[model samples]
Target: MALRFAILGAARIAKPALIDPLSENPDASLVAIGASTRERALEYAMTHAIPNAGTYEEVIARDDVDVVYIALPPAGHCEWSLKALEAGKHVFLEKPATVNEAEARVLVDAAKKAGKRLIEAFHYRWHPLFRRAVEIVQSGQLGELVSAEAEFSVPIVRNAREFRWQASQGGGALADLGCYPVSWLRQLTGAEPEVTSAHQDLEPDGIDRRTTAHFSFPNGLQADVICDMDPEGGRKPPRLELVGTKGRLDIDNPLAPQYGAELKLTLDGQETRETFPRRPTFAYQFDGIVDAIQSGQPVWTEGADLIANAAAMAAIRRVAATG
Candidate 1:
């Protein structure tokens, strides 16, 4: 039996990230879509060929829906996620799970008490390209870990009405883009990091347009992240580089490896480039969701992971504010 899903919002991300992937997954089905209004929900459902459409409350109350995909804005994540869990539906929450650690903790606690699964939508982590890159570092072939650096930058979306430009809606480079690198650092090191320093360029609206943060982990491991919404250059390719005592690894565009990806490794003055099949990260993420629901498998971005990432982001913002 397929795991039936109802999306809580007609978010732009739903098309490529959730609807398409769930449609392609044999073990998953896009059962419905719930938007802010019935008209919007009906249109989105018709466009996506989903069987049902309604308000979020109506969709979650339906017994046919087994999972609720909470693609609402960051501010609404905790509220809708907890609602779904309370309604006895598993939740697939979008990244940056909530605005702060406190909110994430509440959501996590609710999930635990409700006995439902809550998976953060960190799609890139499920990609094989990243898995291979991490493997090389963990193999100790790179020697003891030294430092990790990641940069994710994109041209600022000029739409004044966009939620990303609103501070109250959890808008900013740190919440929008920096979360990726923070989560990546945590995944690579298998440890939470302490924010040592942070700098940000703030907009008149008080949201960050660009941010650079430094983190320190155990064993003298260091990580730096750079995220920019309005980069001087056109959108630069996202990159992650890891350095160790004996060797180093560089990865290009791990965030959306489906476009194209390259992983380079240097050991003892020898360099090799590894390529992976171009597959959508969302597909792998959907597979993980299906596995966790159907087979009792655990996913990497569960509630605890979300809480840790949220806490790290909070720490980064706190440091950035002090400067």
Candidate 2:
């Protein structure tokens, strides 16, 4: 039987985030889609060739839906995910899972109570490029990890109607872009971070356009992240650099290896460069989701890690709230 999904919200991000990947995953199917209005839902389903379209609640209540893909903005993620799980369907949630950690906790607990599987859609994590990076860190090739830095920057979306410009909608450079680096750092170290300082540039309505924050881990590892989507910031590809007692590693475009990624390691006066398959990261993720559901294996971005990541992001916001 195919793993079926019912998506909430006619979100544009869902197309590349899932639909394209779903096209390649034979074990899974995008059976339905829901939007603010039935008309909009029907239009999106028609364009995508998905069979069912309706209001969000209507889709969740469908007996044939095996999973709920919460494709709404960050603000609605927790609420809808909880409802979906409560209805006995698994949940595939978008990033920045909630407005804050407290919200994520509620959603997490609800899933536990419902005895349903839940996963945060950190699509890049399943890619071999990222997997190799994590392995290098764990293999002690970098030796007694010292410090790390991650940066993701893109041109500011100038559209007045863009949801990311609205603070209430949880739109910001940090939430949309920075979360990747935060999750990356936390996952690599398996340690929660202490936000030492944070700074952000905001739009007119107080939405953050650019943010940079420093963090320190329990193991004495120091890390910093910068996510910029402001007018002054130009397109900067995703990159990560790590230094250790013995050597250091640098990764270019870890965000999406298929778009082209390069990894360089320098150890004891010698350096080496490596690359991975250019498969779409989403295909790995979409198929991984289906496998996790059918085989009941654990996924990388599930359980307490979701709340831990939320806590880290929330901590950064608390500190950034100061200046």
Candidate 3:
């Protein structure tokens, strides 16, 4: 049976992220749309060819819906995710899974109690490129991993009003862009690292516009993550570099593989570049979720993983606040 999905909000990311993927996938079907207001919901439903439109409660209560794709602000993610699970529906939650680790734990517990899946929508992780990178690192070709660094930055054209800029809504460079590099480092290291230091550039409103964090792993490995929402120049290519005793690997545009990506391995004084097909990251993400629901396959971003990422983010934020 196709996974019947209902969107919880009319977020801008819904189209390229969730709606288009569901439309392209035969195993998934968009059934309904629920927004903060009925008018907004109906507008989105008509625009997206979704059959049902209503309030979030009404949509989640529908017996025909199998899953809920939550695109709400970070502040509302924890509450609505619990509500969806309580409604006996699986959740495809957007990143930063929750504002904090405590909320993440509550959501994870609720999903377990409801016997439903809660996947953090780290779409990049679903792509084969990342998996291949992990394979190369773990294949012993790189030898013992020494250190890793990942960065994501985009120039701020102007100060604009958005949910991402609101502290109450969980808006900050650390929460928005930092999560990706942090998660990527964790994936490469295969172990959660402790935050050793963190620094941030804050706006007048006290929200961080840029952040740099340092982490130390148990195996004497170290990693650095840099995220900047307001860069001076044009958008910097998202990159991850891992250094081992034997060689080093560098990946370009690790965040959005849909545009294009290249992974270069430098070993034995030779450089080799690997490129992946230009498939949207969200498509892979949707397919993975569908497979997990139908075939009992493990989700890449499971509940425990979500909690760990949230905990790491919390630690980073605490360190940033200190100095």
Candidate 4:
């Protein structure tokens, strides 16, 4: 049976990244949508051909909705996700599952108590390109992984009133965009590198406009990430690199908005290149979530790791505060 999904929010990013893929995935279906704004919700439902539309609470309360995708603002995520779990629905929550670690713990507990699946929507982790990269690194093919570097940034929408510039709504370069590369770094490294140093440029609204972080692991694996919400209006790409004992790999567009990244390998003292082919990242995430829900399995971006990411994010915020 196709997974019956009810989206809790009509997020602007959802159309390009999520809804499109869910529509394409064989195992997933976009069944309904609940928007806080009824007019918008009804319009979205009409345009998308979703079967139902209602308030978020009402959507989860329906027996037909088997799964809930909570794409609300970061501050609203934990509350709605927990509510959905309590309603006996699996939840695919937006990233930064909570504004802080304590909230993440509570949500995880709720999922445990309810016997439901709760997954953070870190879509990049499910991309086949990254999967292949992780396999290569962990297979000893890259010889011993020594270090990695990544960066994700883009100019913010040229409007001061954009939600991303708001503080109370969990708007910031770090939360909205930084988490992308950070999650990728953590996945590629296969360890929670100790966040040794961090820095970020703050907007007057008390949100980060740009930030950079550095982390090191006990195994001598080190990583650095840079994020920016404001950029000059031009095309810029995210950069990914890994250096190992025997060879090195570099991937451009690792967190691409439209396509998968290119994976390049330099080994045998020869430079060879390969393209992983472009596929929407959300498609893979949809596949993973469906497989997990069908097989009674955990999503690859496990809850424990998401909790750790929240802790790391909290620590980074503190470092920024002090500096």
Runs of candidate 3 with Cα error greater than 4 angstroms are 156-161
Expressed as tens digits, the lDDT of each residue in 1-323 for candidate 4 is 98888899888766755688787777778778999877878988898888888888788899988889888889899889888998999998888788888998888889889998988988878876778888888787778778888878888775665777888888898888888777887777777777788998887778898888887876787888788888656446888888989999898887753554578988988887677656777777888888998999877665798788888788788877786
Per-candidate TM-scores read 0.98, 0.97, 0.97, 0.94
Task: Give the TM-score (vs. native) of candidate 2.
Answer: 0.97
Candidate 3 local distance difference test against the native: 0.89
Greater TM-score among 1 and 4 belongs to 1
**What C-alpha RMSD separates each model from the true structure?**
1.0, 1.2, 1.2, 1.8
Candidate 3: worst-modelled 10 consecutive residues by lDDT: 155-164
State the lDDT at 64 in candidate 4: 85
Per-model CA lDDT versus the true structure: 0.90, 0.89, 0.89, 0.82
- For candidate 3, lDDT tens digit of each residue in 246-295? 99999999999779899999998899999997889898988889989888
Q: What digit string (tens of lDDT, one per residue) describes model 1 on residues 1-323?
A: 99998899889998878887887788988888999999999999888888999999999999999999998889889888988999999999988899999999998999999988999999999999989877887788989889989999998686866888888888889898999999888898788898899999999988999999999998677889999999996899999999999999999998999999999999999999999878799988888889888987788898679889999999998998996
Range of the 10 consecutive residues with the lowest summed lDDT in candidate 2 = 228-237
Relative to the true structure, candidate 4 reaches a TM of: 0.94
Note the residue pairs that clash in candidate 1: none
Q: For candidate 2, what's the RMSD?
A: 1.2
